[model samples]
Target: MENYNKLKSLVASIEADADKFFNNGNSAAGTRVRKGLQDIKTLAQEIRNEVTSKKNDEKK
Candidate 1:
């Protein structure tokens, strides 16, 4: 549950940064957006692994 909330927050930040870069044409926002996206991808992979691990354990 906590991780889920963190993921939501990261998603929100990514959207905000994208808006700043695309809508406002702020160059600095682009860097932030890229970083946020990377963070999200890493986190998503971690969560996926955790879920898969649990499923595998259950089957064992």
Candidate 2:
């Protein structure tokens, strides 16, 4: 649940930066958005692996 909240927060931040970059051509904001997106990808994979492990544990 904590991780879920963190993921949501990162997505919100990325959305803000993306809007700034798209609407005003801000390179710095674009960089931040890209970084946030990469974080999301990493955290998402961690969560996925955790869930998969839990499922496997239940099966075993």
Candidate 3:
């Protein structure tokens, strides 16, 4: 659940950059947004693995 919160926060943190990149044509913000998205992908994968592990544990 901690990672879930982190995922939420991560997305929230990137919102400004996303908005800037899409609405204001900021190249630097676009770079930051791209980096943030990659971080999001990694964090999402971690959360998926954590959930899968917990689910399998419950089957025991």
Candidate 4:
């Protein structure tokens, strides 16, 4: 549960940062934001896998 909350907060922060960069209309900033967003997506996927594995273990 804590991991889930942490992942949610991290995603939200990345989204907010991306929005700020997007609003500024800077190409370099936009690129950085895109990279950051991608990183966040990867992290989220890993977290999801961890949670799913834990759930399956509990069921077993």
Candidate 5:
């Protein structure tokens, strides 16, 4: 639960940072922000998978 919450917060922060970079018109910074956003997205997916697996295990 804690891990999931942390990942969610991280995703939110990355999204906000990306928006800032995008609005500032820094192409290089925007690229970095995109990369960070992708990483956060992957982390979020992993967290979701872990949560789903845990729930499945509990059901079994």
Candidate 6:
């Protein structure tokens, strides 16, 4: 749950950079957005693994 909240916050934090990169023409913001996306991907994978682990545990 904590990590889920962190994921949401992380996305929220990246929103401004995403907007600047997409709606405007900010190269630096684009770089930040890309880095944020990579972080999001890694976090999402962690969340996936956690969910899978919890589910398997419940099966016992």
By lDDT, the best candidate is 3
Predicted candidate 6 versus true structure: per-residue lDDT over 1-60, tens digit per residue: 988999999999999999999999999999999999999999999999999999999999
Task: Tell me the spans in candidate 3 whose CA falls farther than 4 Å from its real position.
Answer: none
lDDT of each: 0.89, 0.90, 0.96, 0.75, 0.77, 0.96
**How well does each candidate superpose onto the true structure, as a TM-score?**
0.87, 0.89, 0.96, 0.68, 0.68, 0.96
> 1 or 4: which has the higher lDDT?
1
Model 1 spans > 4 angstroms off: none
lDDT of 3 by residue, 1-60 (tens): 999999999999999999999999999999999999999999999999999999999999
Model 5, stretches more than 4 Å misplaced? Answer: 5-9, 12-20
Tens digits of per-residue lDDT, candidate 1, 34-58, equal: 9999999998888888889989999
Q: Which parts of model 2 have CA positions greater than 4 angstroms off?
A: none
Clashing pairs in 3: none
Q: How far is candidate 4 from the true structure (C-alpha RMSD, Å)?
A: 2.3
Candidate 6 segments whose C-alpha is farther than 4 A from its true place:
none
* lDDT score, candidate 6, position 51: 97
lDDT value for model 5: 0.77
TM-score of model number 4: 0.68
lDDT of 4 by residue, 10-51 (tens): 767666557767787667767776877777788788888998
- The window of 10 residues in a row where model 6 has the poorest summed lDDT is 1-10
lDDT of 4 at 39: 72
lDDT of 5 by residue, 1-60 (tens): 777777777766776667667787767767777887777788788888998998999998
Candidate 2 vs candidate 6: which has greater TM-score? 6
For each candidate, how many residue pairs have backbone atoms clashing (under 3 Å)?
A: 0, 0, 0, 0, 0, 0
